[model samples]
Target chain A: MNEAITTISVAAGDSVETLFRAHYARLVRALAVVAGSQEAAADAVQEAFVKAHLHWRRIQRYDDPVGWIRRVAINKLRDDHRRGGRKERAVERLKADARPDQIEWSNGQDVTALLAELPRQQRLAMALFYVEGLPIVEVAAAMKLSEGAVKFHLHQGRDRLRGVVAISQEQLP
Target chain B: MSEFDDDRMERLLGAAGGAFPDVNTAYAQVQGRVRHIKQRRSMIAGTAACAVLVVGGAFALGSTGQRSNLQPGDHGSLSVDASVDTQSTPATDDTSAIRPSTTTAGSGAGSNGQGTSSQPTGPSSSTAATTTPSNPATADVQTYTCAGGTITVRLAAGALELVSSQPAAGFALDTSTATATRIEFRWRSSSDDQSIRIDLIGGVPVRKV
Candidate 1:
């Protein structure tokens, strides 16, 4: 973490422009890991900033605006996926697993293709938990799921990823 | 151990995530939109002021020296009291004479047949209303545009006209003032709304007040 990050712990007196520049990159990266597409992640973060600005004066009084923004960004991501359809819902399930395979591959290299192989929910669970490093509570808030459900999705997602990646590796070697 | 518990996995995902683009430009884009919205709000405000002055000048000239008998709900009318803070600079209208499309409302006159014949027709049904100029925003016409739509207002002829530039997805209007009449038209796809004001200055539209 950069020295500037410690300042994020307490959100007082920071100009919107300054806070935006400092955390924008990290937030995008975090969202991209769960969003599956760079463009979607960027959009989600952008929306978060807008919402943050709307409530900036009041939010500056909080202990951590970054966390508040992240929580909001994650929720936005979940809402977008929900609006997309059943397939998207499944991917969100996978992203909760906190597993790396659930999130890697947006270089247009075959990440999406690989991800397509897992149940959407499992894939989403893995991506959010492992790639984004968000706690289950935060993930639940972002995913709009109960903690028990997130746990279930993560557990099921890890098993599924283990199965798929193992089979693929065996076939490769 | 998890299948993803490997350094290679972290490196690959980390690099890919790191590939995410800078959000400053995007943020700036939204900020630019905010600024543009502010400007449009001022313009709409200025236009609104112009409308008021134009309409008010006509009203003042038409009724020259008569005492206003405006009472509460005398003819099913409502009142609008606007209070604008001076902290935000008020908008002024540069174009005073050119009003947007004003259409005549052909509502029937009362049995007494006084001055109720030329009442402005709109979505509101009640008549005989007195529209006090939105001080600061003492105009009869205002215009607003956004990615979703374009709205133009002309009050002297007593109607608000709106044109959608793009198909609308949805919309909503929650104005506090109930004194002025309102008419709304919508298509099926746009959702954004911009604000512009017209101000009446010395019987001629002026720039931001």
Candidate 2:
């Protein structure tokens, strides 16, 4: 009985640690695109993981624990934005640090700047769908929105980016 | 539009993500943060338990003192009643001898009531006075001299008000670091830029330059 109990405890610990190792980097990168600052996104993701660790006993029972962490991180980002000061400071740092070489796209376009032009919800949906490669259902779960709402936001975001690209093409000499 | 298809969108977003961070380092940081959070929570819980124990102990002591003090008054009142009963009895030889005893008992009872009543009232009145200043509506304004002028501070309900004698520019309160007991402020004056900290010590705001 003692050996079995020890094994179960070790398994639980390993599983949560495994989840953290698997998803931390991808979540941070995807959130950085939405948050406009790698630092802020990393902070939010770390805070979410900390909370997940504290509540792992209950959270591990969930069908998708990563979904819970994503939701928490996104909510933290939203709260930071609503608070205004920290998010503004992060965006300022992003603006100051952004260089042609630093954020240059392979296609020779500033995709980060383009995404920044999209509304917050659309930007989040687009980043999760494309950058993170999450399905609409998972994106909806993370965003706490319906699948239809996620789809609509994705469609609108695509159209907006397309229009921006076309306008830039028209202006080219 | 055709060029901006799903594949292109994916590639653009993927490229924009730059480089993936080191998972091991991030995991280490997360573990550190978790440990910090747990430490803070435990400290808070410990402090709260200590506070409860202190308050509970004080309350228990206060009640015990009150009961002990009231016992004398109760016995005094009973003795006074007994004295009255003795005085009302017929003036026989035995009653005459008990008259002096009854009078002494009555006077002792009067003094006990006076002493106990005075003892409880003194602390009660002081307690009331001490708590009155803690109420924001009744709080007094505190002033401190700065480089150029004096800043008067008033504590309101969940807010702090500052009034400067001289015109100061860039007066800003750093609410981000505001706590129940301390708040920081910064402002620019003709002399130079100044910063001040206000600490709520014993329910009174004290200015620290």
Candidate 3:
């Protein structure tokens, strides 16, 4: 997508700062949807970009560098989730950051609060499909999940969020 | 669109992944570490070559000095002097001849009494051992008594060397940690070479080839 990617692909002649500035925020946001924590999303996206830059010589010829990075960030999210042992800490962290009036969510207001309550698989599938804009097949592969399972988690995740958000909206003045 | 359909979910899934890291710093860190490892390897190779030269030179000088010290008259004169002093004395019986006489006498007197017979049988028992001619057909360990202690070495199929030692009673025998060579032993010696049996299990040397 960016000319800097081609420049970095050739040799030490390229400046990586240009690529970092261009895609850094988008990559982080895409990863944050998959990864629950802001700090973890930042770290995972940064690591993905760093890996991409090192392999840019080969990756430049590919049709989509952004897709490669999204895949990397998704894998990193899954790896981090597994290493965290349990989702309680990640959920608590998300809850702490989501003050309802302050932090913004991708979907809408208080969406982070509803997402934090979802099972990890559901949240991941929903995030990849909607936030990252990946096709269902790609999302399944990225998540190391079957297509049926991904769809099931997505269905369940959306229903739960709808129930929570609607209940909150009805109670509002 | 329905209130909670695919469109609603898709809208909810919006921009969440964050920006990527500073790519330059990460690349530089990896490159530096790799370069450092390569430099360390080359330095180690140079040091090894220098060590070989120093050891070779020392051995050559020591051998030359030993050759110089051994003049024609030196060893011959010492043997000649020893023979002259022993010429008048009566020849003593070899220990082999006297061993069997003591064994036969000890066995004839005692048939029982383990502790009672063992008391007087100590010296006589050792004397009995020298009578049998040593069989060279089978493997036998040669024992050497040095100033530090006694050492028993059995010759087998491979080369062995004490590459490095920390001079401790329980120091582990190891090659270099960088290399995947290691050795472990169960026994500990309180003093140098103090009554140790270097059991060559399956005839393997206690060193890396």
Candidate 4:
């Protein structure tokens, strides 16, 4: 991520486009886990990128423009969730059309479903810190929460996952 | 369960965020949305500008029309008041002689009689004559002498007010013909008969036989 930001800093002329091309895919994927729908996540990231494009002159001067984009995307998602109707409809559609051929990283475990079980804040913190490989501070900034809050969410999420794993193991035996 | 640690969680979460379905199409869509927003803002700004221009143009045209209709004698307050008061004076054989008398009375009255004479006396006398045709009221008394008696008419609140009549027996005011712009008073007796038609055209009275 720092490499991508450095590349953007070096090529200031087309920084917004460069940043979009570099980070758009990763951000969409991470937000998909947080949003629980690929389409909704993609839309949020696209809106964020559009905003970044409009305000690039000010955004390009920031320490991390991608962080700004991430924050905007997260905020968009949060706003959509607060609207209730759209988020519920999107969740219902996602559940109805649950795809079985998702590429797994841990022996075919459904990581998206596992993360969905966590609370909204914990889910976002986990996705940003682990999936997006961001530090606790960046996660806090993107989530617009304090670093201590992000840490607590991360801790709570980890404990929840551990309990799920323990329960699965016990069921298998 | 021991193997399910932070590294495992990172790997699982990272993998759950699969590759984007379509990047090129999305970038194009974002650019399109930005252009659309710009077009909408420009349209709103253009509409507001046109509305302002239309209102300003109407006001300017109205002002120009009012100025063009104003008579040369309508400039001074004294002359305007005198013209309203003495509009009912009978037209002499030489009509040009009436202009000097009207100006002389207006200038000679000074501060005593003219001040009290300028005020309107009718029940509805708030409005006064001006160059603007929008307000057509002229709340000054006008006296016309006919063969039978003298009739007084005053324009107030877009209607003709009959202030007084000396004998009221022979003179008959046609109420249907009375308006802010025109009035007709007819007097008939055994010896004399006459009709006085006073029309206020552009705040100046024109007597028709």
User: Which residue pairs collide in model 2, if any?
Assistant: none
The candidate scoring highest on lDDT is 4
User: What TM-score does structure 4 among the candidates reach?
Assistant: 0.55
Task: Return the interface RMSD of the candidates, in order shown, one decimal each.
Answer: 4.1, 6.8, 6.4, 4.5
Give the lowest summed-lDDT range of ten residues in model 4 chain B.
B96-105
Quick one: ranking by TM-score, best first? 2, 4, 1, 3
Model 3 misses residue A138 by how many Å? Answer: 2.1
What tens-digit string does per-residue lDDT give for candidate 2 at B137-186? 22333333333222334455434443222223333322222445665545
What lDDT score is found at residue A143 in candidate 1?
65
Which candidate number has the best DockQ?
4
> Can you give the lDDT of residue B144 in candidate 2?
36
**lDDT comparing candidate 2 with the true structure:** 0.59
lDDT of candidates 1 onward, in order:
0.48, 0.59, 0.46, 0.60
Model 1, residue B45: C-alpha shift (Å): 4.8
Docking class of 1: incorrect
Model 1, residue A55: displacement in angstroms? Answer: 3.4
All candidates: TM-score: 0.46, 0.56, 0.41, 0.55
* Interface quality of candidate 2 as DockQ: 0.23
Candidate 3 lDDT over residue span A1-173, tens digit each: 11222223323333345555555554555556555555677667667766666677777666556567767876777776777733346656666666433434444324655567678778777776666555666667777779888878877988777776566556666
Error of model 3, residue A21, in angstroms: 6.9
Q: Candidate 2 — number of clashing residue pairs?
A: 0
- Cα error of candidate 4 at position B208, Å: 34
Stretches of model 3 off by over 4 angstroms after superposition? A1-24, A58-68, A85-90, A96-110, B1-7, B15-209
